[model samples]
Target: MNEFPRMSVRDTFARDWYLFRLDLLLAGMPNKKVAEIRKDLRIELAQAAQDGEFRQALAGLGPVNVLASNYLEAHGRKVPRVWAGLVAFAVLLYGWLLGVISLIEGLYSAADQIRPDATVEVVRNWLFVQARVVAGPEGVDSIGFSLSGWGLLGWLAVLVIVPLICASVWRAWLPRPTADQAQRA
Candidate 1:
């Protein structure tokens, strides 16, 4: 019989603990059960180390340990898919809200220009004056004033609604882990 060389106590224990965690995750064990398994595995590995049989035990367990690790890795990829969907939803919703605000502002501007009391030049001058008043000279040449009633409303709506949406979605998607799960991790 070909015998494998002995692994050190620390190395054997570390490998066994890592494999045990992977096995628990792959087995879809409940959080409490996983914690229990981990405790038991630690005790067993410690005893095996004292008995000088740690490497022998690990060699026997190696194939199943590798399989469990692979399985857990495969399942882990699904978490990123959920996160990606959340980010895409947030970006699209923000863009849609901004588009609505822009459309309303454009309509209001057009109506202001068409009023009986206003000429095109008068409306243009009024806009320039308002922009300068809000932004001062420095911003006049940049993006102009963004502190209009519509702009304020848009900013307030985004600030209020985005956090509420995110909080609600997070609660629905990810409930708090149980104490046992937290302990295991």
Candidate 2:
């Protein structure tokens, strides 16, 4: 006959405790509160018998879906606002990065138009024409590129700085987490 090692009462409790905590989190119980509640439950479970009694006690907590539903329905408003801000930030960042990439691509396209066979004067004249069409009558000024490095640097700064600024603003606009939400963190 083969013998298998029996699971300890503590081990059984630990496994059930972990599963319960996960269900609570998925149900929207904040992290801090979940830990506290779990601690209290562990003490209760330890006092109970390790056989059917412990299992029954765990089942009495109710189903996982009910726990999650209760938390989300109570905090639905705050959750949607957080999700909206995150989505807005994502959209803005994507648009900004796309604009920057398009600008770089346009510059490359103009450079490619210049052939090795073309004379310097011809190249300069062709570029002048292309710039006027692409950058408007103001040419380089319209495209924000000057002989000095400031044009590229300034736009780069805008690209990097804007997202951070918007993110800070979004965070500030959010409602403070409630006692319940904080527990669910």
All candidates' TM-scores?
0.29, 0.35
Residues 1-185 of candidate 2 have per-residue lDDT tens digits of 42323446675865576566544344333556556656666666555544536666666756755654555556532332333445555775577566555655566456445433432221121111222113322232223222225655655565556566765565567677778855545
Model 2 lDDT, residue 92, Cα: 59
**RMSD of each predicted structure:** 12.6, 11.3
Q: Candidate 1 lDDT, tens digit per residue, 36-132?
A: 6566665665566667777675565566556455533443311222333456567856676566555445544554445543222222222112331
Q: Would you list the clashing residue pairs of candidate 2?
A: 27-68, 29-184, 30-183, 30-184, 30-185, 31-184, 31-185
Identify the runs in model 1 with alpha carbons over 4 angstroms from their true place: 1-9, 20-24, 64-185
- Candidate 2 residue 102 C-alpha distance from true site, Å: 1.1
Which pairs clash (backbone N, Cα, C closer than 3 Å) in model 1?
none
